[model samples]
Target: MSYTYDYPRPAVSADVVVFDSSTDSILLIQRKKDPFAGSWALPGGFMEMDEAADATAIRELKEETGLVVAQVEQIGAYSAVDRDPRGRVVTVAFMAEASTSESIAAADDAADAKWFPVDDLPELAFDHSQIISDCFSKSDKG
Candidate 1:
């Protein structure tokens, strides 16, 4: 069953911030596609029709970085009108912890995946820089 509407709707996506507490670093993936190709960004993608935001985050993480996370805490939702270049995309961001001992290999839409110190990260794609900053701010308070 399908329905069509005259009004437009924003696309939804999910992003994950995988922090390695032991090293004080976070996981980043080099995008393999345009709109930010070669730039570092969080592991994420558009949500599927059958899955929830959190599930999308976990799936994208595993597909792009080869790291599976069982649990994640919701950071928040980003709905800035100009957030995504492709269109009006609202992203739900999640945070998770992974052990440095776990190995990650770039796959799917990611050209490369690696860890970077939270304070010394490279220029990130989209609104990721802000998202990461927000995550840290929230964590610092708790």
Candidate 2:
């Protein structure tokens, strides 16, 4: 018998869940770019060549949210049909626990950024809501 592995080629991206302990809010941004314009989403972007996934996530958090990650860990991977508006995309979600959430803002492709309470979240673009759900579920496990 011959064995083969169909290599999966999906665009890799990272999502940063910046949490604000002061207000108990999570960071979200209004995407200025396509795939989901004028909609709320976590601070994230695609990975560059030779970039590590966790590093990319942190980098994205800094680039998009002006917030440095004090601690970060891999949450999970999300890949589903039509997950992205552009094309098939696979995202490696990473949750960042920042020491201080204050003084954080948005830039780059984010039109506007702000923090919202977890209980009062806005309609999110893509399957980010599900990703957040998964993150909380994982947290509940431990």
Candidate 3:
């Protein structure tokens, strides 16, 4: 059941911000692909046809970082036109808390995975720096 659309549709993706409050750190992954290869970013990917945004966040988190988070709260949607270099892509961001003790390994499209202090993060890919900042700001307010 494929149908052609007259207008172009933007790709939708989901991203997760896993924060460890005790350590004041966040989990990040080094991308393996060319869009931002070797750069650190959140655990995320394009959404699948059948899964919801939250499900995409969880699945991508597990697939890329080998971390299974039980739940997450929505941060918000980011739809900046130039956010993604690949094309017009809008991302729904989610946040969760995880223990720094939890084991994680790089897999799938992630070259590496590790936790970094929120205040001392490496340069990030995409709009991830802004995403992380927004997450913290929201948390601070709420």
Candidate 4:
């Protein structure tokens, strides 16, 4: 079977803001590819055809940082037309808090993965700066 649409379809992606409560740090990955290569960003990527947005978030987090968080809550969705330089991409953001004792290693499309204090972060890629701000604000209240 084949299906096609006359108009363009925006791609869907999932991003996760992982906060280490023990150290008050957030996980960030250095992008290994273009569109923002070498820039720090949240651990996330495009959803797979067979997975839900939430599942994508979890999977991306594990793939990029090797950190397995038990629970992740949806924060919000970002749909800025120019959010992604690759094309029109709509991202669903998820937030989670974990312990800094958990182990992590960079993999997949991430050149490097590390934790940064919420008060101090490197220049971020995409609209991650805004996403982190929003996620942090929500976490602060909870």
Residue runs of model 4 more than 4 Å from their true location after superposition: 1-4
- Backbone clash total for model 2 is 0
Model 2 spans > 4 angstroms off: 1-8, 99-101, 140-142
Instruction: Give lDDT tens digits, candidate 4, residues 56-91.
Output: 999999999999987789999999999999999999
Model 4 deviation from native, Cα RMSD in Å: 1.6
* Candidate 4 displacement at residue 45 in angstroms: 0.2
- What C-alpha RMSD separates each model from the true structure? 1.5, 4.0, 1.6, 1.6
Provide the lowest-lDDT 10-residue window in model 4: 133-142
Lowest lDDT sum, 10 consecutive residues, model 2, at 96-105
Cα displacement (angstroms), candidate 2, residue 119, comes to 0.5
Pairs clashing within candidate 1? none
Question: Across residues 30-134, which tens digit of lDDT does each residue of candidate 3 receive?
Answer: 999989999999999999899999999999999999999988899999999999999999999999999889999999999999999888999999999889889
Note the Cα lDDT for every prediction shown.
0.95, 0.81, 0.94, 0.91
Model 2: per-residue Cα lDDT at residue 81: 76
Candidate 1 accuracy as TM-score: 0.95
When 2 and 4 are scored with TM-score, the better candidate is: 4
Candidates, ranked, lDDT: 1, 3, 4, 2
